[model samples]
Target: MPLAVYLLGLAIFVQGTSEFMLSGLLPDIAADLGVTIPEAGLLTSAFALGMVIGGPPLAVATLRWSRRRALVWFLAVFAAVHVVGALTTSYELLLVTRVVSAVANAGFWAVAAATAIGMVAPDAKARAMSVVVGGITVACVAGVPGGAVLGQLWGWRSAFWAVAVLSVLTLAFLVRVPAGRGQAATGLRGELRVLANRRLWVAFATIALAEAAMFGVFTYLAPLATGTAGLPASWVPGLLVLFGAGSVLGITVGGRIADARPYQTLFAGLTALTLACAALAVLADSGPALIALVFLIGLLGFGINPAMSSRAFYLGAAAPTLVGASVTSAFNVGNMLGPWLGGVTIGAGLGFGSVAWIGAALAAAAIATVALALTLRGRQPVPAQARA
Candidate 1:
């Protein structure tokens, strides 16, 4: 892998830390800003909404720009918004900043993924994606926790300041990234034509469903651990750490093999994920079982990510940057849908274990989707460029 790929991963790490650290800072932010906790939580939702909607438009807007320029511009915007978010006392201003920052983050992600794939051979695409995704997995393990600790020791604003500084540092390193090659030669209309491909949409559906399966259970893990599994509150953090650790391992292993065997990788990982969720549903009363299942779920769930991501690039080969945007949008859709569905089950008085069951159902659906994608992919003629 190129050094530039690792640098792109570093950039993702900084942005991802900002994306996730808000979960830890919401309480402090609510108190300081004189809003309800739920209201403060909307900041997180706003960011998600921005990510879901922001990517494609930004990708098109910057479609003609050099990858290096697009990335640096997005990073600068990300950093500036965080600085404003850190200094702002008005809740509304802070909310606006979060949305702006998320837009910038989305743009950066699209450009970076396209750039990473551009730097690598077609056979190594998944491995390159793993390096990029690894940054965010590491963020989940280290950056989120570190930000929480920073918030507990100082004010929550301190966490925002820290993100701003990290973004600046990442921006400095991004100067080394090459001005990417093989941009879509056909202008906007030709690039947009790629979206008409049925296989590409199947790939998108598979990714969204897989992520929904993962996050449905994950969003409710704290309650599942403490209430159903009988673990103490302190153990919740440790369980989260364990899950993150498992994710790191999953992504590492998945990256190495996904390019060589995309369909097999997706099937195996999603099937194991479904089984893991079912096991969690059945064994939630046993603390040890719950702990083990959490790690296993994390491993199996994230293990398929490289294949999921690389599929988009492979199928959407004609429009790499726009496809990157679609990948981001698909992921955020899953992120939102999973938690909302889980919340519905909980609100309907289904036990916490219901989320695990929900996860299982979603994973099963994802497996079915993968089968459909494979069947469709087999029927479609492979592009000559892709064969090379």
Candidate 2:
């Protein structure tokens, strides 16, 4: 992999660590901020809201800038926001910081693929992207668990501080990126025109609902581990390690085959996800079963990422960057919706395991959506550009 690609991965690690660490810190944050657990959980939703709300506009606004410049600017903002987040004692201020950090995070992810594509050989684009995405999986494997450990040892704020430090180092590594790519501004109307395709919206909905199934169960994992599975609090990090390991394998394999069999990957992944969720719902109390199911859940949940993304781009080839931004927005919408739905289940006295059952339903729904899209696809002809 190119040095720039590795640096981009490191940047993603910084941003993703901050984004995911909130799950591990929920209890501590709830006590420190004097908020209910549900209220603290909304912090995840708020960050996703920022990503959903900010991603596309940021992509369009910075369309003409060098990808490297846009990336650096966003990372700088992200790092600074973490500093504010770490120091803030007020819950509202922390919430505001999460939103700001997510806006920056959204912009970074919106441009990341485009930047990676620009940096490497054409044939290497997918490989390069996998490397960048691997950073996220690696973060799940290490950074998040590490953050949890830090929170357990020092305080929740220390996780934010560590992410800030990582961001600074990533910024230093990014000095190698070029300042000029001669990228011209795309017309807003032209980009918006891509949204008119029925198939593209189908793909977006598929991504949203598929991810909703995963996050719905995942957001409450700490409680599930403690309350439902009867695992010790200290065991959470190890479970994350297993999940992240599964994710790494999933994404790596997905990246290799996604170009040729995008839909197959999507179908298979969602099917696996559905089964995993259902299994978790029934067997969560069994220690060994929970551990095995958690890994399978991670594997299936993230396995199709490359295929899902490539499918979206294929459907929206007319506006690649906008497609990227739109998909990022869609993923965060699922991220927000998942936790919100999970929280609703708990509030309604459905118990923690119900979260997994609901997730299974959502994944099944996504499978149906995929089947419908496939049916429509068989009836309709592929666009020549999309075929290319």
Best by TM-score: 1
Clashes of each: 0, 0
Error of 2 at 248 (Å): 1.3
Give the whole-model CA lDDT for all candidates, comma-separated.
0.90, 0.83
| Model 2 pairs whose backbones collide | none
**Tens digits of lDDT, candidate 1, 1-388:** 9999999999999889899888888999999999999999999889999998999999999888899999999999999999999999999999999999999889989999999998999999999999999998898899988999999999899999999999998888988999874354768998888888888888889888889899888878889999998989888778878888989999999999999999899999998999999999999889999989988888888889999999889888888889999999999888888888888998999889998888899899999998898788778897654666
What range of 10 consecutive residues in model 1 has the weakest lDDT sum? 179-188
Quality of model 2 by C-alpha lDDT: 0.83
- The deviation in Å at residue 104 for candidate 2 is 0.7
Per lDDT, the best of the predicted structures is: 1
Native-referenced Cα lDDT, model 1: 0.90
User: What are the root-mean-square deviations of the candidates from the true structure over C-alphas?
Assistant: 1.1, 2.3
Q: TM-scores of all models? A: 0.98, 0.92
**Alpha-carbon deviation at 89 in model 2, angstroms:** 2.8
Residue 346 displacement in candidate 1 (angstroms)? 0.2
